[model samples]
Target: MNKKYHDVFSRLDQKDKDLLREYSVKNTTGVIFDMLKIFEEHQEFKFIYEEDGKQVNLVEISEMLKAEPLSEYGWIARFSKHVKDHEII
Candidate 1:
């Protein structure tokens, strides 16, 4: 937490702080699954990709699940995404 944003966080009322704390702990995990479900319905996955030596982010690509069950397929993904800024954390 930076000193610049300390006032912003400190100004929150107890109710607001409680709500934010609850959401941060409870809803964080669901966010990923919700996004995945939405993308499954849309038949696409948005990810970063490299092109011409530059990383193009939020690139939408179509995907299909492999025929085999995940257990049989060993839950393999063709590629994984890494957030450059969040790598250390």
Candidate 2:
């Protein structure tokens, strides 16, 4: 992984860290599915199309979630809002 990416991952909160660890250990497909489940309810979470015509995937989303320059409390609040808006656990 890139150093910047690794740095981002290293700074994740406990819950996000746990999720990353779990997803890394499990099937990538399952991880993607779970991400979609979360994203579906969060309008702010959307696919970013690249010039190469590739759609953003779960790994990228996870990286973003981990790297967002917000306080732990802010991250949780946003995450909770997304969950509540989408009725996701």
Candidate 3:
């Protein structure tokens, strides 16, 4: 695991961590990166799974990623839909 991402990596549940580790071992590129792109674009942590059969929302994931050093930057921006140019507030 990369030291830079240790905080976010630690925030994940063991199951999620294990899965990420497995992906790291099995893939050199593409799959995991694509998955990250999809996750960030979608902005959801529980996007890949359900808890007690309930769907997870962006707010929860945002809170989780908020403390990560790089999460508050561009990496998360890609997940958000910019409507500021269209919506009049």
Candidate 4:
């Protein structure tokens, strides 16, 4: 898993793109690079979106983020999203 901006952009789905659009975020390499830089410089910097009543972080970690169904003790319990949106947690 490469950390290059292109690699991240490649993995972005329509939902991800829409999230970025809602924030007026540009997909340009330079912008993404700067955003990553900001994240690296600030420990508290986070770009978050609420989906399924759960927070999805786009900056802190990638592999651990997902858009899953909300539950009292699902992935949200670990602050991570999952791909299954229909299973009972």
Best TM-score goes to which candidate? 4
TM-score of 1: 0.31
Q: What is the per-residue lDDT of model 1 for residues 1-89, given as tens digits with 9 covering 90 to 100?
A: 79877888699987887677667634643565455555456645645567889875332433432221122232222233424342321
TM-score of each: 0.31, 0.27, 0.28, 0.32
lDDT of 3 by residue, 21-41 (tens): 657634633454555556565
Judging by lDDT, tell me the better candidate of 1 and 3. Answer: 3
Total clashes in model 4, counting residue pairs 3 or more apart in sequence or in different chains: 0
The digit string of per-residue lDDT tens for model 2 on 1-89 reads 79999999788987897687656635543554566556555767765646678677543566454334243453444654445333232
- Please give the distance, in angstroms, between residue 18's alpha carbon in candidate 1 and its true position after superposition: 0.1
Q: Score residue 23 of candidate 2 by CA lDDT.
A: 68
| Residue pair clashes in candidate 4 | none
Better of 2 and 3 by lDDT: 2
**Native-referenced Cα lDDT, model 4:** 0.53
lDDT of 4 by residue, 1-89 (tens): 35697788678987886676545523343354555566656768776778889996665654322222123453444665433542222
Among these predictions, the greatest lDDT belongs to 2
Give me the displacement of residue 23 in model 2, in angstroms. 0.9
Model 1: residues >4 Å from true position, as ranges? 32-89
